[model samples]
Target: MSRVAVLMGGRSLERQVSLKSGARAEDALERLGHEVLPIDAGPDLVERLSTLAPDVAFIALHGRDGEDGTVQELLDVLGIPYTGSRVSACISCADKVLAKHVLRDRGIPTPDWHAFSETAFRELGAAQALPAIEERLAFPLVVKPAGQGSALGIKFARTAADVPMALVSAFSYDRKVLLERYVPGRDLAVSVLEDADGEPRALPIVEAVPNEEDFYDFEARYEIGRTRFVCPAELDDELTGRASELAVAAYRALGCEGFARIDLMLHADGGELDVLEANVVPGLTETSLLPQAAEAAGISFDALIARVLELALNRA
Candidate 1:
């Protein structure tokens, strides 16, 4: 068995959640007969990693520097193989605008979006940007930081009146923000993992049914019972298969390897489905979407963790 170091708990807004995912991953890795060490990533991350130097690094981090290629860059410089996408892929996926552009260029179905910076919004009256955005993306748009995870700095706006507030909230997280056309319908996520044959394997689709609000937000994601997870998404076999294919396509289009989660919307108007965004290091907690998908695939939590470790080791 390989000695593995699972890194989590970074200087990001999702530190607590990362801590929880790391703890669970540690337990799972140990159960799989592997030697494991759990490290809380911080400003001293490089120093701490140098001291532990394991066979591979299992990154269970989410949000900010954790998912935005910072950790991957350090691992690359150290010549250590870690789980998830490479530095370039991680950075590309971390930026919502860039990912959207890549997906759109590939003829993949993604919501229309416009990138706006604070300087542009404040100095240049939103009229130019607003009209352009209005022409492409309609009302009821989604405002989100171009680089964030775990639902932080995400807002659903119904009218232009909500633009200022949404912009401020999203800009608070990152300098770049995306205004995307909101695709109304069921919220679903598809997890993709590369099989031993080096081919992408799409897991079962997971439907997110909000218990209280109209959309699944941060509260619904972390708070217990705030959302219902229906495995296999209760959709027709055709739609399920199509969604699964679309998800894997998005993953490959973004050049992500190991594992990733693709969020989608099954449009309410019976139109074509739309891709929301992709998560490179999807949450590994007990309640996260990837774990839930694995459960539906008959892979126990321990087995899922083992699979992730196996992929990391083989890639190394």
Candidate 2:
């Protein structure tokens, strides 16, 4: 067994979730008979990694610096192998604006959206373009931070009047904000994992049904029992195939490797599915969609962790 450093609990808003994921991963690593070193990633990350010098880094960190290529670059400099996407892939997955552009450019179906940086709105009078944007995308827009995951800085704007406060909520989490057309329907997620032959395969689809809220926000995601999850998503043969295909396409288009979870929305009216965002380091908590999908696909939690670590080691 090799020495593994599980990085988690950064200063992001998703810190708690990352900690949970790290803890679970640690348990699995221990059970697999590997030495596990849990690191609460902070300013002393370099110092700690240098002193410890683990064989591999199993990143359980989420949001901001964790998923935005900051730590990946550091790992590269330290000559350490890390799990998940590379620097460019992390950059693409961490920013919602970039992810959507990549999906659209690859001929993948994503929701119609617009991106605005703080400079554009605060300095260049981008607010003047709001009316035109609303006219194009229509009402009930999904305003979200361009760089946040786990639905942290997402808000709904039912009308033109709601856009400002929604923008405020989104900009608070990130400098850039993504304004997307809301598809009022079922919540779906598909996790992609690499096969033994190094092929990316989409796991069974998982559907999240929020018990109380109209949207699956932060609380609905981590606070268990707030939502009900259905593995295989009850989709028909054709729908399942399409969802899986889109997921694999998104994964490859974003240059993701090892593993990733693709979140999507299935529209009720048109029955169309649109890509929301890709999570590079998905949560491993009890309620996280990836673990649930893995279980449905007959891969146990410990086995999943082992597979992820194996992929990283093999790549190195």
Candidate 3:
């Protein structure tokens, strides 16, 4: 039992989801007999943390300032150890484009993709090069804001004509946008937790199967019953091991500490698995995937939260 500040509800686009995550974490902390101080991250975040002087900060915030290294750095400056990844990992994982680049550099399997900034499209005439990129990546691409999470600004471009509108919508959320080749297959999530040896181990893979034949968008993700999550993903032993190994590799490549969630796509055609991105501060809500994966791995929700808190205290 320690003084733990659960940070949530930031000004980011994922504010609502973050609030739910933070509330859940706070409940867990209370159940575990820890004094919890829930803080809605905003302009007075540093001020509140300084005033409260909590021993640790359990970050339930997602996207933007929450996952982009902003809040983590502030906590570091205040000398409060926090749960989840460090500042560098947060920076790398928060930006979809940067995380993919890191994955590629580490010889990890990630989908082929391209990124563009709003400035590039408007001032530098990057739009004219769309046809070339489209030809290279092919049709039915996924367009998303480079830094937003909870699939906030994701769009599917089924054809060349759809690309412009998708980019516009994505750019509305973030200055940078990523266009990736669509892998028509199973959407899988691998949650990685450190073992006793401090080695990252992959939890049971959770496959998100949408009820309708459509993209697993934000609505389908957060809203319960919109998508069915199959624990262990119904994969064969060899494929499961391969997926687990890849998940660990991605976690280590990003320098993530404590825990993280790696999202991957398994191709329906050849079963080629490729990582999409890493979520440094994965959700902890009732319908979140990380908890379900943990549960499938035989870890209860309370135990999972306790383990995460213990890991954060290890920095001391």
For candidate 1, the TM-score is 0.95
Decreasing lDDT order of the candidates: 2, 3, 1
Model 3 agreement with the true structure over 42-118: per-residue lDDT tens digits: 89999999999999999999888888899999999999999989999999998889999999999999989989999
Count of backbone clashes for each model?
Answer: 0, 0, 0
Candidate 1 stretches with Cα past 4 Å from truth are 123-127, 213-223
> By the TM-score metric, which is better: model 1 or model 3?
3
Q: Model 1: per-residue lDDT, tens digit, 1-316? A: 8788899998888898899999999998888888998888877889978888888999999987778899999998888889888888898899989999999999999988888777777788764667668657888788898986778788877788887788889999898898988887888899997776568888999998888864625445546777788998898888998999999999999999888999999987874688888899999887888998989999888887887777877887
TM-score of each: 0.95, 0.96, 0.96
Candidate 3 Cα errors over 4 Å, as ranges: 216-223
Error of 3 at 16 (Å): 1.9
Clashing pairs in 2: none
